[model samples]
Each structure stands twice: as C-alpha cells, then as structure tokens.
Target: MNARKTWTRTLGTATAAGALAWAVVAAGQPSAAPTSEPVAETGPGYAIEDYNYPGADRILAEQGIVLKRGDGHIVLADCLSEENLLRFLARGRADVCFKVTADEGFLTLEIPSVHGVRTDDSVNTHLAMTAEDDRVEYDIPAKTWEGVGESVDGREHVLVEIRVTK
Candidate 1:
C-alpha cells in the first residue's frame, strides 16, 4: 500500500492510545491553524538548525545515556559506535543525526532528514498532521504540521519531515 495512506491509517486507527504512545509535544496548543508564514530559510542571524537544537543539557541529563533505560525514561539505541557516541554526546549529531529533547512542557525528537516538535500535558494528545514520508522536495516549505521523533526504546526513529521549508 502507499506509504502516506498506510501511515495515516496506522495513526488514524489509533485514538487515545496512539496519542499517549506518540506523546507529541504540541504542549496542548490544540493544533490550531497555522497563522505564521512559511519559515524563511535565510532569516537574520542564524538558521533553522540553530532554533531547532538550542541545547541538550537538560534532556541528556534526564535520559542518562551513560546508564541504561530501566523504565519510565527513554533509551537511545546503540547504533552509535564508540567514536560516534563521543561525537554525539559532545556535539549531538551523527551522519544520521537523531536527537531527542523536551522543552518547558514538551518532548521532541529529530531524525536524520526530518524533525518533530510537539507539546503535551499529562493528558491525551496527537499531532495535527503527519509529514514524515510525504515526499516534499523542499525544506519544510512553509510549516505544515509534521515531526521527527524517536521510539520509546530509542532503538528506531521516525524522521518526520524537516529541512524543506522555504
């Protein structure tokens, strides 16, 4: 079957359970309609990457990558080699560049070619849309709702659409 429909069906099929499982950080924004214009690529000082990855101190400490994921907390896969681990922890990137983070009241994940920024509360929630495998040839050309996320086990990732906005 087509990937889009498949993904949609998979997500749409789930109701409360999926929302809790995905745990998007929409921060209870209610997935409102987009009011802002497409995020400009060459904005003033820096770029989208900067805004996307502000820091990893809090999240890193929280996950405790050095240790193992026992329960309740998330776990990153051992896909990283010894060399890659050092690079990722220090600089936070690999040729694959998968990231996990949480903000004031949100949790997020970024994958190799995409990004997922959602907010959540202690209740049920899901993303407004899915753009993970949608074949957009641009850098998120405008900000249609999408995301890149990691799995609970952190063994795999969902590199939702990103870096395609104009």
Candidate 2:
C-alpha cells in the first residue's frame, strides 16, 4: 500500500512537470497578434572599420595635407598647440606638426617636398618618402631635428609615412 502511494505521487509529479514544460514551450511559440501592418525587414546597418583618416577631405582642403590612414595613435596637430610635438617641414609651405599620444604610433600621409623632421622627446622616429621613382628613409632620434627627403639629395621627395617608437 505504501509502495502504491509512492508510485502514485511520483506519477502525479511527473505529469505536472510535463504539463508545466509544455506550457512554457507553448508560450514561447509565436501566436497571432492583432496587427494590421506588415513587419518591416529594415534595420540599422553593420559597422565597419576602414582605417581612413577622419575629416580627411576637409583637412586637405584647409591645410593641404593629404592624410590617408593610420592607427589613430598619431594625429595632426597645431604647431603652437603644445611642446614635444613631431614637427615636419616642407618646401613652399609652412611647417606641420603632429601629436603623439602613445609609445608607438604610425601615420601615412603625403606632404610634397618634405625636407626635415623634428622628433619629440619621447620617441624615436622613422620616416619614409619618395622622390620620382626612388625611395628614401630616415631614422631620427628623440628631441632632434634631422634633414630628410629633399634636404639630403636635392630631389623633391614626398613624405609618405611616419613611424615612431618610444
């Protein structure tokens, strides 16, 4: 008699649990709602990273600097904005400066007739430029101004890339 009662209780509990699970699953299923409009399929698009410089067209128009792309650690800045800036000199134009926020940085740009680069106090800088069909590179020490590009060879060189390490 005790065994029969135990079996009966177990069967009842199992049936209740099964019914509860079925109710939960059925509740999750889609049902007809009182809507007259069709569902739209549109949504916000995905985000993508292209690495192109922001406001590049505006800066090119305003400053004549052809900024291409970078890792965002190095950026164009006002020459007089702060000290310890990476300064660049180009012929037929004013000196350009950049601010470095990290221990390492990279920027690719085009500045025609670049002849000199001044490194900040914290980073050793490497510069790459091109003149006609030849490529030129310079390694500049921290807190030093080094003549690069056309200053060394008299050929007009376009500054292409700047890499710095602390």
For candidate 2, lDDT tens digit of each residue in 75-166? 99999999889999999999999999999989999999998888999999999899999988888989998888888999999999999998
Question: What stretches of model 2 exceed 4 Å from their correct place?
Answer: 1-46
Question: After superposing candidate 1, which stretches have Cα over 4 Å from the reference?
Answer: 1-55, 63-139, 147-165
| lDDT score at residue 71, model 1, on the 0-100 scale | 22
Global lDDT of each model? 0.32, 0.92
- Clashing pairs counted in every model: 18, 0
lDDT of 1: 0.32
lDDT of 2: 0.92
Q: What tens-digit string does per-residue lDDT give for candidate 1 at 36-131?
A: 654564456443332232335554565432221222122243434322110121114533322222211122343332233321122222321123
